[model samples]
Target chain A: MKLFRMLRRHIRDAFKSVFRNFSLSVASITCITITLIIVGLSIIASLNLKNFTTEIEEDVTMIVFLDADTTEEQISTLTVEINSIPNVEEVKFKSKNTSKNEMMQESDFFKETMSTWGEGDNPLKDSFQVKVKDIEKIADTAEEIRDMDKVSVVNYGEEMVNNLISAFSMIQKVAIIMVVALIVVTIFLIINTIKLTIFSRKREISIMRLVGASNVSIKIPFLIEGLILGFIGSIIPIVVIIYGYTALYNHLGGVVYSNLITLIQPEPFVYIASLIILGIGMLVGMVGSAGAVRKYLKV
Target chain B: MDLIRINNVKKQYKNGVTAINNLNLSIKKGDFVFIIGGSGSGKSTLIKMLYREEKPTLGEIIVGGVNVAKLRNRKVYVLRRKLGIVFQDYRLLPKQNVYENVAFALEIIGAKKEEIRRKTLKAIEMVGLKSKIHNYPDQLSGGEQQRVAIARAIVNNPKLLICDEPTGNLDPERSKEIMDILEAINKEMGTTIIMATHDKDIVNRMKKRVVALKDGRLVKDVEKGGYCSEAI
Candidate 1:
């Protein structure tokens, strides 16, 4: 019961002090707010970038072109050989006629030119569309298929795809490192901000100690003040995340530049991201206050 | 009947200055004792040791039956709860009013709301600051601020009241007013009072038990005496 009363008083004192030292409190809150907003935006961008990369990775398919004179039996054997590879996920054969028809449908120019070619004089090659279960081993799988009989060429945009994947991975790594560094910087900034607040009230704290306040009792109010500041600081960032992300998603039509680079749907994604921002803000705020108070307690 | 017993206490600063060296003193309950000394004569160090503010370098200090010299820093607040301390600067929270300032002592120690109200008002009234209970420290005179400090000190009803030059900042008239409140608390509640001061006039006028220190040694102890300039 006595503990409950003390906690109540600590909370009251924290709120009173936050307002009593309004400028200092504002400085702390502003510091948290600005840092958390950057953090939130970075998280949103990194996750969306990851989503886009994964989508593109899944869409990658290797095309194996066969010789125009290859027999149906040889094609069947080649399909079997390709499917036996450990990385080969799926294989589908496309006849020359079907390929020609697809090209015709893609454009009026192809339709106009292709209609003049007789069936016997057609020059399109039959091919197998291949998908691999593991993107990392796609090169090995492509090599194995190329050595097969009657195979003329194998193409999956190897260099461009490899470069794209590696570049995306590097970007993701840099994004994560940037976010971590920002959080670390925020913690230090918040600690110094709260230290200033405590320094201003050194006289008040000395009086409290002389009056017999325990270390825990003396620290409780400052900790609560940090928590309150962090909570308030996170509010604007949360608002920005929930509304800003959805608006950006809507304005961009859920994709950036093309369908391969898509944004994450904002339904639960925004909510989850908002929660993360809130957690970071509160945790950093409390840690900063605790650090400042610990230093003062030592003195 | 001894409320505080210092057995050969010694305090040496980190700079190699021995503030109190092999000093012994004791005060009975309800006694008004004055510790008089020149600057740097170990009077402040001796009083600070009583509340566990400055741990003695060598010796035992027992206040209210607890040995404060060996008390841990984590448990210092426990020892302090049994004593009240007033400083030369009054040390009242500048933002708090007289009533809140007095109540703050009890509030921090987790006293109940009703009990805090009763005791805080009683302590404030005892210091004769009932009319200025709502006044802030800046709004009050130097004497009134010192009275509030006294009220805060005694609000917890500590067994010992320690004052380190409580009236050093006040004029003669205001110093007398502050002294009157301290005297009332000592007589009415039987709280042992230990005060360190440089004011020879107040020391001589009070005619209380005077303990004089010189160069970290207790030089003179009198039953009812005036301030002495040196060892006698």
Candidate 2:
């Protein structure tokens, strides 16, 4: 019975106080919204960047130009041997003639050069192209391919592959750092806003206590107020993220088309993931208000 | 039968002042007792001791057969339910209207909604503030506020009604009116009334039992009391 009375009064007091201090409450809500938005956007950006890096890693393949003196049996043997290496997904064979033909199709200028080469003494030779099972192990696969027999030369832009891998790792590191930093800011802002709301209701709080209001009843109203503000705040950022994402996508449509290698770039999932991050912001506000009121009530 | 028994209760302040000392008394259920003293004669301290708001330095107090001096801190809420306390300042919540303030006592104790409403209305009528039921504490005059405070005190139908200078804030006519209401409550309800006041006017007219203190000691206990104008 006492619990019911306290719960009812707590509801009434929280609503009255929240309405009574509208401007300060709004200030708290806006701050929470902005915090959630930034955190959310960053989360979405990080997740998409991760997926992009994985796609790029899967695409990386190494082409081995065979020795000029290698025979058909040796070439076949080499293909079998190369395929046996750890992390090798598949080995594709391209004959010397097929390589020249592919080069010729690239341009009319390359066709002339291709036709000038003598038939018997064609410098192009059959080679094996190695696709790695996992992109992360591309460097190790390349190193093992270097020591294989009948393999004259291995060609894959080692520097480019290394730079791409490093860039992906850096993106992940930076994203984690950004997430940690934003969470701290969100908590601080949310806590301060809750504190202000609590301050406004100090008088009402005293009356409740003097009237023998239970601690739970006194806390529930403030807790609800905080959650409402935080929930409202979380929405603002999601909208901003959606607006900014659509605008960016519209204006950068050409860039996305031209640059197929977007491994380090954030995609649409980044935006959705950012909205989830806003949920965390809401949680921070909720817990913060509850904590502050618990301290203040001390009953 | 004895409803309250106090034995040698003492309270010494930090400034080396003895507020209450070796206080011994016994009160019955129908007793209307006034604890009186000069300004620094420990009257207020003695009243506070009854509520356990201030514990005694020595001895014991039992109210309604419960050992109040040894009462657990959290259990004070239980003790307070049977006890209705009124302060000199009225201590009426400023934001609440008379009816709400009166109902507040029931709300804390979780009374039934209809019962709370019915009883609050009755209390308001008893204090003759039914017309001002919706008025806030500040809107009413000093006397009205005190009456509201009294209405709040009696609304719970507590066993013991302790008034610590409840009429101290009112004028002579207003004071008389408050005393008359208290006297009527005493006659009708059989509640134990323990009032602490330095007021000489209301003390004389009540013609009830009076206990006087001088410099932390019980100096006089009178059957028919009057103002201590000569002592002052």
Candidate 3:
């Protein structure tokens, strides 16, 4: 019962101080909200970037045109050999007839021009479409398969794939640096704001200390004040993240750049992002106030 | 047994300023003792040492059987819990009213709600500020504010009351009134009172036990002494 009463008093004092220094509280909340908004936007951008990169990686397929003089038995043996590669996930055979039929269905000119050509006269090459498990190892796997006999030429957009991988890696690095810098700045701002709040009431704290108030009693209220500030600060950013992300998703209609890039759906992504922002806000507030209060608690 | 025993206590500040040097003193329980010294004579340092605010550099200060110099940081608050210290500035929370100010002492120690209310009112009444219970510190006179401070200091009914120039800011009349409240608390409750002061008139008039200091050393101690030996 005594412990409960003490907790109640600490909470009461925390809230009282929060309003007692209203301007400082608002400034702290604003700092946290702005920092969290930046953090939230970065998270959303990074998540979508990760999704887009994965889609590009999955679409990377190596097409291996068979040698024109290779027999059907040799072609089948080559397909089995290609599937045996460690990094190769799937190998699908596309016969010349099947390729011609797909082209005729896809284009009106192919349909008009290919209707007079019989299967015996088809100019299309029989190829094997090879998908790799790891996009980073795709180049090595394609090289290995290209050296195999009966393989005429292999194309997996080698230069374009290399550029995309390097660009994505660079974006990841920049995003990480940005997130860390923002968090550090947020912590510094919170510490200064809380230091000011504690400075304003330093007299009261000294009096309490002289009266035999324990260190825990002196610090708990300030910790609670920080927590309340953090909680309030997170609310605005959470709302903004949800509303902004959903609106962006709707405005872009899921895909960008002729269906080449896609945004993550708002279902679990927004919820997770909101949770992360709230967590960061609370953590920064707690840590900042704790650091500020430690210096004045020498009594 | 002595309520407080200081054995060859030495206090040197970080800047090499010796606040108190080779000081030895003892006070019995329920004794109202005056610590009389001029400016920079270590009167404040002695009173602060009694409450464990500033530890002696070289000796042991045993208060109520506890060696304060050896007490750890976490246990310092426990020692302070048994001591009620009043300052010259009347360190009452400016925003808190008389009742709240007195009650704050009990609140910090986690006293029960009913116990806090009863004792707070009793302390306020003892200081003759029951009428000003709801008035804030800024709204009260200097004397009244000091009374509220006294009330807050004694709300927990500590075994020892240390006052460092409690009436330094008040006029002679107001200082006497505050002194009267301290005397009443000492006589009625047997709470040991160690007061540091520079007021010669009150020290001469009260005729209490007086300990005098000069150059951080105890120059004189007399039973029923005045502010100075010549005055006695």
Candidate 4:
């Protein structure tokens, strides 16, 4: 019952003070909204960028050429064995003639390279293009494929996979750093705003002090006010993020024209939006309230 | 036993100026005592000590069983709940109405809603400002504001009511009215009243015990006291 009463007081004071200092309260809310909206958009953009990179990495494959003398029986057997390798998703073998025809389709010059080979001579050998679950394991899988007697040359370049992984990690690190900086700035700005409000009401606080109001009574209300500001500020950003991410997806789909860039699914946008809202809101509110209340409540 | 006790109390300013030096005094319950001192003679500091706003430099002040000088910040307000402090400036919040201002004291101490309303209305009526209860402090005169302040201070029904130059800003007639209200509160409630004043006419006319301070020293203690020159 007492706890309820205390909570009641906090809520009452928070609402009263907001009405009491309407302009300052509105300014604080606007500041938080602008800051959080940018933060939320930043998060959504970075996450979508990450999803695109991962899709690219997953689609990458290694082509392993088999010895020219290998029979169709050997090629099929090798394809089965490669498929059984852990994390190797699927192994597809393109016969020598089929690869040559596909290459020719890419460039008319490749047809000349193929025309020289007579019917008795096979210019190209069958190759297995192995798609692995993880891009990082591409090198190991290719090395294993090369050691097989049926394979003559393993053409999977380890450097390309490594570069992709490194690029992804770099982007991840940059996103994390940006998020951290935004959070810190959010905390700093909110705290300074709360401090200014407290300074404006110092006279009233002294009167409360004179009346012997408990430290918690004085602090809880301001803390609730900070929370209210945080909550109100985050609403615009969260709405913007949901609508913004969906719009970006539709825009990306139209702009790419080739269906090349993979878009983020709608489900993850919720997780991202929630992360942006609660992460910045709770941190900014709790920390700013604590700092301001410490200055006002003597205890 | 004394209701309030001050033993060899001393107060010093930050710039090495001493306001009150080795002042000792005591007041019994139901006694109407007046503290008289010239300006800068530590009247404010002495009043502050009673409320635990300013602690004595070197003495023990026993008010309602607490040693105020050694009290913590949390304990200061607890001590204050037992006190009714009326300031000269009337320190009423400009935004609050007369009723809200009076009820604020009870609210801080967690008074029940019904009781706070009852007590606040009763206190305002006691001060004869019932009609002006809804008016803001800025709308009232100096004397009415002072009366409102007194109502706020006494709303909690504190055991000891301390008035520091409460009539300092009022005219003679207004000052007398405030005094009359305080006297009625004292007579009706039997609450101990300690007033610090420089107005010799009012102090003398009230025919109460007077404690006089000079050069930061308590020089007189009288029963049924009159303001005489020897004390200064």
Candidate 5:
């Protein structure tokens, strides 16, 4: 019961100090809010970029064309050879007939041009549809398959996919670096501001110590004050993340330019992001306040 | 019984000035003692050491059975809680009113609300500042502020009270009022007091136990004596 009363008093004192030093508290809150907003934006961008990269990775497939006169036994041998290559995930044979039929279904131009050809006179080449376990090593797997005898051509839109992957990876790295740096700056900013706030009250703290207040009792109020500042600071940024992200997603039609580069769904994503912002705000506030009190207050 | 025992205590500052050197003294329980000395005489340093503010370079100081000379900073609060301290400057929180200021000491030690209110009021009444309980520190005169400081010190019912120039900032009339309160607390409640001061007239008039210091050494100690110029 006595411990509970002490906690209550500490909380009350913290609240009173927050208002008593209104300008200093506001400065700290503003710093937290601004940094959290940028951090939130960076997090959202990085996560969405990651989603786009994964979607594109899943869609990448290597198509290997075979010699036109390959025998059934030779085709079976070729399938086994391709499967044995490192990183080869799955292989499916597409007969020239199936390719021709797929082309016909795609447009009337292919249908008109190919309908006159008989089964023996078909000029289309058979191909193997291949997938790899690791997209990073897809080029090596494709090179191995292309060097095999009787292989005509291997194409997986290599240049475009590689370029896109490199670009997205760079952006993701920069976003993460930005988020981490901003949090660090916020921590230092809070420490300095809280130091100023407590400097004026150093005498009060000494008097408290002289009157026999324990170190923990002296620290509790400042810590709680930091928590309150952090809590208030996070509210605006959280609102921005929830509302701004959903609005942007809606404005861009849930995708940036194409279906492959899409935004995360708003339901759980924004809520989770808001929770992260709140957590960061409170944690940073507490840490910064603790640092200030420990270094400056002496008690 | 001796409530405080100082044996071969020595305090040398980092700058190489020895504030106290190989000094020993003892005070009994419920004794009202005066530590009389002039400037740079090591009286303040001695009082500061008693509160563990300035640790002794060597030796042991046993206060209320606790060895304060070697006590750690983290545990200093335990020793301070058993004692009341008053300063010449009257270190009251400017923002806190007289009642809150007095009640703060009890609140820090986790005293119950009812006990705090009763004891805080009683301490203030003892200092004759019951009428100024609602006024802030800035609103009160120096004597009233010192009374508030006194009330805060005694609120926890500390067995030992240490005063360092408690009447230094006040006029003769105000100083007399403070001395009267101190005497009443000592006689009525039997609280041991060790006060450091330079007020020769007050010291001479009180006729209490006087311990004099000069150049970091104890020059004289006498029971029921006046402030002596020969000792210096």
Candidate 6:
């Protein structure tokens, strides 16, 4: 009962000080808000980039064209051989007639030109669209398929795919670095702000010390004040992150063209991001106030 | 019984200045003792040493049977809890009302709500500021502020009340009222009062036990002494 009363008093004093020093408290909250906003944006950017990269990885497929003169038996055998490759996930065979028909249905110019050609005059070659389990091994799998019998040409946009992978990986690294740097800067700013608040109340602290207030009693109010500031600071940023991400996702109409690149769905992603922001705000506030109050508590 | 015992206590500052040198003194329980000394004569240092604010460089200061010099930082609050200290500057929290300022002393020590209300009101009444309890420190005169400081210092009913020039900023009439309160507390409640002061008139008028210091050494101690050795 005594401990509960003391905690109540400490919490009351914490709120009282925050209200009494309104300007300083606002400044602290502002610093935390801005810092968390930057952190939130960085997180969102990293998440989107991650999703886009995964889309790219899944979209990469090796197109293996067979020799035009290959017989049906040879085409079937080649299909089985291609499917047996280590990293090949699935091999889809496209007959020349089917390919020609798809081309004729896709465009009016192709239909006009292809209507005069018979099945025997079809110029399209039979090909296999090979999807791979892993993007990194796609190039090696394509290379292996190139040396196979009846294989005429292999194309998976090798250079473009590698460049895209590297670019996304670099973005991921940079995003991590940016988020870490922002957190460090936020902690420094929050600590200094809390130090100022503690400085203004140094007289009160000394008076309490002389009056026999224990160190824990003296520290509890400031700790609570810090937590309140951090909590208030995170609210705006979390709202902004959720709102801004939803808006961006809607504005983009979809992920990227071809439906491969996509934004993380708003529901669970925003909820998780909000949790992260709240956690960072509270943790930073605790650490900053704890560090600042330690020196002045020597009395 | 001796409530405070100082055995060959010596205090040297970090700058190599010796504030109290080879000082030895003792005060009995319920005794109203006046520490009379000029500026820089180590009157403040002696009072500070009693509260464990400044540790003696040489010897032990046993207050209520606890060695203050050997006490750790964490235990200092425990020792201070048993004592009340009033300063010359009247260190009242400017933002707190008179009532809250007095109650703050009790609040910090985890006193019960009813006990705090009862004791805080009682202390404020003793200081003769019952009507002005709602006023802030800035709204009060220097004497009234000092009274609030006194009320705060005594609110916890400390075993020993140490006042360092408590009436230094007040006029003669205000000083008399403050002294009268302290005297009443000493005589009526038998709380040990050790006051450091330069107010010769109040000291001479009170005719209490006086301990005088000169250049960090105890030069005079007398029973029923006046402001100066020759005056009595």
Which residue pairs collide in model 2, if any?
A: A40-A274, A44-A270
Candidate achieving higher DockQ, 1 or 3: 1
Q: What ranges in model 2 sit over 4 Å off?
A: A1-13, A21-24, A37-102, A115-138, A144-168, A254-278, B1-26, B36-76, B89-96, B168-170, B208-232
- Where model 6 places Cα greater than 4 Å from the true spot, the runs are A66-97, A108-126, A132-134, A144-153, A251-263, B229-232
Provide C-alpha RMSD values for all models, in order. 2.6, 4.7, 2.2, 3.3, 3.0, 3.1
Residues A1-299, candidate 4: write the lDDT tens digits. Answer: 66676678669878787777888888888888888887777777677677778887877878888788898788778878888889799878788888777888888798788878765596777788888997777778878877888678887667777887998889978987898788678778878887787788777777777776777677777878888878877877887777776777677763244566666776676666766686678668767876777776662
Model 3: per-residue Cα lDDT over A171-248, one tens digit each:
878877877787777778777877877787777777888888888898888888888999999999999999998998
Best by DockQ: 1
Chain A TM per prediction: 0.85, 0.80, 0.91, 0.83, 0.85, 0.84
Instruction: Give lDDT tens digits, candidate 2, residues B1-232.
Output: 7988999888888887898889899988878999888888888888887876677888899888778889765555566667777888887876578998899888777788899999999988988999999898989999899899889889988888899999887888999889888887888887789999888777887888889888888888877776565443
Error of 3 at A163 (Å): 1.4
Candidate 6 lDDT over B1-232, as tens digits, reads 8999999999999999999999999999999999988888899999999998889999999998889999888778888889999999998887789999999989988889999999999999999999999999999999999999889988888889999999898899999999999999998888999999999999889999999998799989998998884322
CAPRI class assigned to model 5? medium
What is the Cα-based lDDT of residue B9 in candidate 2?
Answer: 85
Candidate 3: what's its TM-score on chain B?
Answer: 0.96
Report the lDDT of model 4 for residue B120: 96
Task: Assess candidate 2 and give its TM-score to the true structure.
Answer: 0.77
Report residue B51 deviation for candidate 2 (angstroms).
4.3
* Candidate 3 structure quality by residue, lDDT tens digits, B71-186: 87767788888888889999988767889888998998899999999999999999999888888899999999989888888888888999999889999999989999999999
Worst 10 residues of 3 chain B by lDDT: B223-232
In model 4, state the lDDT of residue B137: 92
- Model 6, position A21: C-alpha lDDT score: 81
**Candidate scoring better on DockQ of 2 and 6:** 6
Estimate the TM-score of every prediction: 0.92, 0.77, 0.94, 0.88, 0.90, 0.90
Lowest summed lDDT across 10 adjacent residues in model 5 chain B is found at B223-232
lDDT of 5 by residue, B96-120 (tens): 8999999999888888999999999
Candidate lDDT values, in order: 0.88, 0.78, 0.87, 0.83, 0.89, 0.88
> Given candidate 3, what's the lDDT at residue A172?
74
Where does candidate 6 chain A have its weakest 10-residue lDDT segment? A253-262
Q: How well does candidate 5 match the true structure in TM-score terms?
A: 0.90
